[model samples]
Target: MTQDSRQSVYERITATIAAAIEAGAGDFRMPWHTDGTMSAHPVNITTGKPYRGINTIALWAAAQGAGYGSAIWGTYRQWAACGAQVRRGEKAALVVFWKIDEREEDAGDMDDGQSDPRRRVLARGYPVFNAAQVEGYTPPPLPALPASARIAHAERFFAALGVTVREGGTRACYIPARDEIRLPPFAAFRDPIAYYATLAHEATHWTGHPDRCARELKGRFGSESYAAEELVAELGAAYLCADLGLACEPRPDHAAYVASWLTVLRNDARAIFTAAAQAQRAADWMHARQPFAA
Candidate 1:
């Protein structure tokens, strides 16, 4: 894709997500949500490979808006190849991928502090329809899981992280000063999943402490940096929850930060990329601390 097309790609995706946030203001249900699938990343039906980076956010937003329960999505040609047909009147979701091309270059790898002329980075986008939009593709439905399940695995995994977690409080938060995590008694949460999900979120925050990952964690509650950090923690929690097979539902409390995130993304189209990368780092940090494979 050309530079102009790449700009259009970012604008188009940002617009789609911005519109979804506007429509979901009251309900607070949109992208960054998972249900019975237990936080499975959206995957392409043809490739059966999970999307990464901004495409994850875009597809999740599209699926949530379209009420697609199955996480399978594919392009028109891909759907046909998979023996599935996109139903008439169904709209396709936008998905982007990076394409690298090689051309003739000088002997030196770098020229005048610029990248090698032989290599080029291209941002390409295509349309993909979710399983719900495909007529002949019946993705096996995920069994409904009751609110009550053994979250003991999650508890054990997180507890082994070696972070200082203290109970007994109405709010759950991470204290960067002392690198401590505080949460209400486990019994206070309506379900074990909620309790562990919240814990996972705070633990992600704790990973960003200055003594640890040392991310930009000093921003006040409503600042852009603060919103960015929260987005990282949210995405990190989603990654962790998926690994632990736990529902990573969007919390109503995070509604206040959505506008800030939108502002950051609208001002800088690449903000989502940075957020996703940092989130991956945060999740990796937590995962590395796990005592052992469960």
Candidate 2:
């Protein structure tokens, strides 16, 4: 594709996510709640691979809006190939991928005249329908484990990070300077998932320490940068929760941030994109540190 095609796709995907975040700012809900149809990570039906980066945000928003409970998604042809038919009236969700093209002739600085690892990655999208939008398809059954059963996994997962977490505090926060997270006792929370959800939020924040991910952290209080970082932490936690099969309800404490997030989105159409990108970076950082357990 040409430059115009790449720009066209980038603009479309950014606008879709920005609109979703803006709409989510209204109610402080991004549709990752337990009450929603799909509580697990959004995945491709054909590939069974989880969607990552901004695509996760896009698909979750679409699934929440459409009340799609199934994780299965695929292109129209894919549905037919699987012996299923997309409902005639069912609209498909927009999913994107990067199309890379390498140019060996353009390697001007290479002494050996070899093609560098560099390649132009273009943003492109396709329309995919959820299994709920199809007929004659039965997704294999997977049970949603109870919060009690998931507690052990959540504990081991975060414990593997080895981040300093202190309980007994009413307010939950990550002190970047000290590099520690404070939270109320897990028992004080309504359930185990909420406890872990809040911890995941702070854990994401911890990943932003200068010694760690070293993200842009010097934002004025109440400034757009600060709001953007908070957006990243919250969304990162949501992504982490999805990874661990925990419920990702928007905390009531985050309600105060809606107006701030909305202000940032209103001023810059791409703010949500940046937030989603950083959020993915944060989630990936922690994911890399997660230890595999039998």
Candidate 3:
């Protein structure tokens, strides 16, 4: 395909995935159990058992939203691809993969179902290509980098929110329950520019804890509620990252529970809006906490 043609195809796939996630159609799997049971298994970090019924699925989804934000998968570009296979009876297993630019030497020896080694390989800024070889199709150029001054300012802003800043990695933010706020290893930051973008994301999560905004913040991974929370956090980070000129990260895990989130949003359009508003507030709150330079 011509370069432009390839780009168009990539964009179309990305858009389709985004649309599915927005509608809550791809977050959890309806696994067909051996004992004639259908259960919801979250697509992110796998759990041992399945969620027994729709009620359990809904509850799990909600808790995930409260704790993780709106989208469980993280962000948009992180998404690689999603596909489904029919098992037996009225059940199917859905598979989703996140794009990883770095390859680990140890990954070859590790067993399947173990913690992904790639998760530990710090991301090195936005728009890292998965390469057509990795994705089974050609992809467009990485998303544009946000302006720099704004990103620097955002870094300082997040530092004020108590998150330690690091450089050279993809955008990743986490709430270290014990520490005030710790950035992942500097090696994890693959590039200098994404530092602030990632910090903004973690800062949003910190907003959910009891000592901070006290959002609900609990859910079984991949439930409808969890998907919603992922969306909230995802959007929150996106807004903050945008203000500071950073590309929004991808949320590959969101594919598993996209359908669930859409259902909830459709059921209460106002709820989605409210969650986004609150997430924005949380981001602002973190920003305001930063210390002014001397």
Candidate 4:
């Protein structure tokens, strides 16, 4: 297929998969295992093995499901290959090529019913490149923050989120055991305005603690829940940035979780609104906490 056509196909397939996930479609399982009429070629490390039948193919798909962060669905390269010859009434088996990372071997290479489970070796391999290379997909640059912002502005942002910032020698910002917020020395604060921006972001997260707003902050770093929190913080920062007429400095750390965010957003249309509200509340809480200059 032409590159453009292949890309179109990939987009369609990925969209379908994303929609299915959003609609509550659980992990993909081997159809043969569900039915009872398919098998795979025996693994021969010496000669390598070709994926055979729908069950084996589905198993590979299941393995792909375990990918995390931006690595999910690692580089799929599909090509139509010759089918196995069959008897007069038998259906032909199409060969589906899968070039995945060696790390996925354990999940992808499990035998249906003829091997010791302990024999599985989780060896890892790096792929130079298989497919995920699309042109013109550059991410927009992160926004920049200006210098010369007052410490009071930072305090105000914290107060709006219902947190108070304590002055300390250190230049870092953190919530104090879910009670009060503490910020590092303003002098120590790097890029004063951005430092507060970062503080606002973290303060928003602090609100989610059980002792605070009690937002569920329980998910693996790359899972949907974590991504949701990140989205909240980003929105919160954006809101505060707009209020202060500051540039919205993008959180570079968030790039790692972008795929998961995409997944969550695709799954729930309402999630964006909920996260945004919580973010705004957090921003407001911070703004309320700033000490007013007399």
Candidate 2 residue-wise lDDT, 136-240, digit = tens: 998887875776667787898899899999888689999877889999998899988888999999999898887777777344223577888888898888888
Model 1 lDDT tens row, 3-35 = 889888777887787777666767776576675
Q: Pick the candidate with the highest lDDT.
A: 2
For each candidate in the order shown, give its overall lDDT on alpha carbons: 0.72, 0.72, 0.41, 0.41
Candidates 3 and 4 compared: the better one by TM-score is 3
Clashing pairs in 1: none
Superposition TM-score, candidate 2 onto the true structure: 0.85
Q: Using TM-score as the measure, which candidate wins?
A: 2
Q: Sorted by TM-score, highest first, which candidate order results? A: 2, 1, 3, 4
Per-residue accuracy of model 4 over 1-294 as CA lDDT, tens digit each: 355643443343334334433333232221111110011121211223423222222222333343211111222121111111112332212112322333343222221122255553332222211112222232224344333443455455455555566677654444546466566666765466666666656666676666655666343223467677876665555555545544444444444655675577466533443454466555555555556522
- Model 4 spans > 4 angstroms off: 1-152, 155-190, 210-212, 217-223, 287-294
lDDT minimum window of 10 residues, candidate 1: 105-114
Model 3 / residue 186 / CA error / Å? 3.2
- Misplaced by over 4 Å in model 2 are 1-11, 18-27, 34-39, 102-118, 217-223
The clash count for each model shown is 0, 0, 59, 23
Between candidates 1 and 3, which one is better according to lDDT? Answer: 1
